[model samples]
Target chain A: MEAVLRCEGLVKRFDDRAAVDGVGFEIAAGETYGLLGPNGAGKTTTISMVCGLLKRDEGTVIVAGEPIDTSSVEERRAIGYVPQEIALYPDLTARENLRFFARLYGLSDRMDERVDEVLDVVGLTDRADDKAEEYSGGMQRRLNIGIGMLHEPDLLILDEPTVGVDPQSRNAILDSVAALGSLGMAVLYTTHYMEEAERLCDRIGIIDEGRIVAEGDRRELIGLIGEADTVTLQITGADGCAERVAAIEGVESAQLEGEELIIIAHNAGSLLSEILVVVRDAGATVKGVNVDEPDLEAVFLHLTGKALRD
Target chain B: MTTALLLARKDLVQRLRDRSFLILGIIAPFFVAYILSLVAGPVYDYGFSADYAISDETGSVGEGLAEGLVDSGFGAEVVGSEDAARALVDDGEASAAILIPAPSPVGDPPPIVVYGDLDDGTAVVVAESIAESIANQSDAVRVLITETGNPASVGAYLGQEPPVGWVQGDAGDKVLDGITYLSVGMAIFFLYFTVQASIINIVEERMNGTLQRLLMAPVGRGSILFGKTLSSSLTGLLSMVVLVVATTLVLGAAWGPVWGVALLSLAAVVNAMGLGALIGTYARNAEQASQFAGIVATVLAFIGGVFVPISTEPGLFDTLTRISPHRWLLDGFGANSGTGTVVDVLIPTLVVAGIGVLLGLLAFGRRSKLTGVV
Candidate 1:
């Protein structure tokens, strides 16, 4: 399948410092690619270059087989960008706002149809006549997303769409985003939220500092942890228990957190009894135990040496 | 072009919805114009006024001179003696004392000696005026006595049957009312604020991230900037038109020739918009831009003599005042009366618009560093 978006050696510099340093990625048709990282990790900057919002210092961004040109209005129409900020005229009605963006995109022939379609997709058709400022935060965010899709662009770029939203609104936005991928629109999603990336992305790229550190399917990326499972034990009087657990076979490392002792091993389920035995032998009482399977958060932590939330 | 128009329309609509912009741009101008017109005091006589004394002579020449001066809105009184007339001036009862000497014996007409307290500027002005009036009347007396051989009958002097030819020519009427000047000046001043509001909207959009979204849209950056400038210009134009019409309807302000005022207003709007764009380019945010625009507008208005009429007798201050667009606009409007044509308005209009375009281009260049200027 032809890729909907591709970037190679994207580099953007501010003065002497590189904001996006030689970063590159591609998104195929009908796929959701998530750039997962902590804040200031060049995710927004990289996407900005891809969407032609910022000038790249050294790079080529091809969207739907055309070089990304910030000066070319037609070339930019292939990709829709929903910025991090809720960018809308607060005094204008939802319909007016949509019409304005639609006009900007040169969608004159079927303007009303397109606006109504996007508003319905975002479930804002009922309140289309209300001023944007009168809408709740969630509604405004939905309208923001709706504007990006008005032109039916091949690739939609959403920059941190769910930041500062209520949980219900966040979930609604996530659901809408997840639904977009299934409808055959390539999505380039950028977020510092690990769960959002995990829940919606088909392929994820873990970026740090200013470059993508790793990119793959969830299982393949998580395998970077090498078959390791974390075992958490709620224990009391766990003196020397970490040393005891680390000495057990197949256990790689162990650490204690308050009353909980954590053990990383080759197979946490099989080593649970042994870990408990080791803890008890060290004169500590094991209240409970849990073995967690590898996930993207672990993959992020393993690769970057920092938690996804950090 | 369509994109630019759409963006411009969007800005105009949003500006219309902004309450603060409405108050500052429209309501405040009319309010201030009305209040300032009241503070400017009533429209007094455009001509001058003074008081003078004339001696009671045997002939009717002295009384005739005093009557002519009094009928022309001056204060004139006949005195029994020259000393009493001088006393009236010394005691501040009259501004000047004029003594008509006895008839000439050597065929040369008698001189009308005028006395005044030169220390008092009004007295000096009155004395000079009386001296001029009496000098003109003395010429008429000489002509009458020479032609008709009669010095007692001054009735012919007051009528067209005077010995000297009295051919009269029409004088130009007042250019405009004082209140109208105040209205136009205030309108132009507030129109600058309207332009500032429009340009500052761009900074507000940038701060709110809508500008970034616009950049990502399928429209050239030039289109965005052009649309913004056009919107600012339109805002200024609309505010001015509303002010003009409202003040005319409510305060009875006379706006000379419709086409002339329109053309001048267009030029003023263009000029204001350009300055606003330049200010917006330098300012980092909306608040800063607004503050800077306000200060600049006030300074321009003051120097342009928006609150007070500057003397127009070719001086350094009048030359300096010409640098401001407000002066040119008011000049254009004031010229609308008395056979004024489109060219009178067009000259200032084009000059202001040209200056605006230059500043707008510079502002576009500065703002274009991030993107391309429109």
Candidate 2:
């Protein structure tokens, strides 16, 4: 199936530095794609280019079937955008804010219905009558998302929506995004949080220093790191224990820092029992054992030699 | 256009909810206008009078001069001696003393001695004006006596029927009392604040990211700008109209024709909106925008005769009056009855509107350039 959103060779420069340099990605219909990076890693800049808020030095963003043109009302209408900041008018009630945006989006024919539906979708229907300024931060963020989704556009672009949100609210927002994908809405999500990408995105694009360093699904990305599993052992008096664990079968390498012995092994789950026996034989009292499966964080570390959050 | 209207409506609603707008834009102008009108007291006809003491030495000429001063709105008390007249003036009973000698014998005019305290400059000026009128009347009678081949006794005849008749009218029909002037002045002055608030709203949105969100919406940037400006202008126009009407109804302030007031109010709003847009476009942030807006509004208020009538000043100060829309608006409001025509009002009104349109276009162009939004 044709992709709902596609960007090719997007470049945006500020002064002499390229904030978003030759970036490109695509999101198919009903799929959730994420651009994961740290702060100042150009994720917001790239998202801004896609939303037509910033003029790209070079690129074309095709939304739905049409190419993105900031001046074209139709093209802009096809994409729902939720900025990182809560952009609603503080003095206006949530419903009023949604209605105003709905009207601006030319949904005047069913403004009330759309506003009500979006408010319900954001779980703010009960408190919709209160002014936005009276809302808690999480509720305000939810309202911001509701405004973006009001027009039911072909694609939704959320730029770090969960930033500065409480944990419960962040989970609620994540669940909403996952629900949106299940409902067949194409989503382009950008964030600095790695776990958000892992939990919500079907496909992840690791952006670093103005470029997409890696792009893949969870399995494919973790496969890039040679199928290694991390085994961490909390021990007591575990001096000279790393060598003992390294001699075990299926163990590739072992390192001990303080009382924690971490082992990188091939097929670590199958070799855990033998590895523990070796630790015990090495005169170490095992306090705790954790077998960490390959995940995006490991994949990111393998690809960039730095943590995903660095 | 629908988007523009929605945006305008949103701005209007926000402004309505803001209490500061209600106080500054609506209540304060009327309050200030009412206080100023009360301070202006009551209006009266064009006339001046000051008490003058007439001396005993002067005969008919002194009598005729005293009579002329009385006719010209001055109180005259004839005393037996100059000392008595001086005492009357010194005791604050009379304004001045007038001494008339006996009629000229050899066709030489008699010398008149007037005594009063020179410290009272206003009393002195009024006395001088009354004295000048009486002297002119006497000269006219002398000339008539020479020309008409009548006897030198023509002074008595002229005194009975003063040749120089006075027909004074109230200082034009347009009564510019304190209330009327202050009402319009405060309205126009606060109008700058209203328009500045609208521009600051734009700056705030830009700072807070709503501007970008709006740009990303289906609406065009022109529509957003147009909607925002229209709302601000309407807020100013409505606030001014409310203050004018309320003051006129409550305090009985005569602001001339309703249509004239409205047209000028609209023109003033346009001018303010344009200037506000320019300030908004030039400012880097909301704080800078509000600061620049306040400075511009205050400068215009001073130059436009808001605090004091700059037009009354001479030379460059009067010339600088035309630089601000406040001056034109005040001039437009000041026009009434026999003083000005509808055309007179429309010219200044149109000029203000023209300036607003020009500045608005410049602001729009500059906004597009600054944002690089095509």
Best by lDDT: 1
Model 1 ranges with Cα > 4 A deviation: A230-291, A294-298, A305-310, B42-176, B312-316, B337-344, B369-374
lDDT of 2 by residue, B1-374 (tens): 77777888888888888775788798887787666555533211113345888875635666776776678666887878756776777778886666454555565454344344444433443443344344445642221110011223323433232233110011112224445666777888888887778867887887777887888887777788778877887788789778877977887566887788888888888888788888888888888888998899899889887876432323565567778887777767766422457776787799888998898888877885334353
Chain A TM-score of each model, in the order shown? Answer: 0.80, 0.81
Fnat, model by model in order, equals 0.77, 0.74
How far off is model 2, as Cα RMSD? 10.2
Off by over 4 Å in 2: A225-227, A231-289, A293-310, B38-175, B311-314, B336-338, B369-374
As for candidate 2, its clashing pairs are B58-B100
Stretch of 10 with least lDDT, candidate 2 chain B: B165-174
Candidate with the greatest DockQ versus the true structure: 2
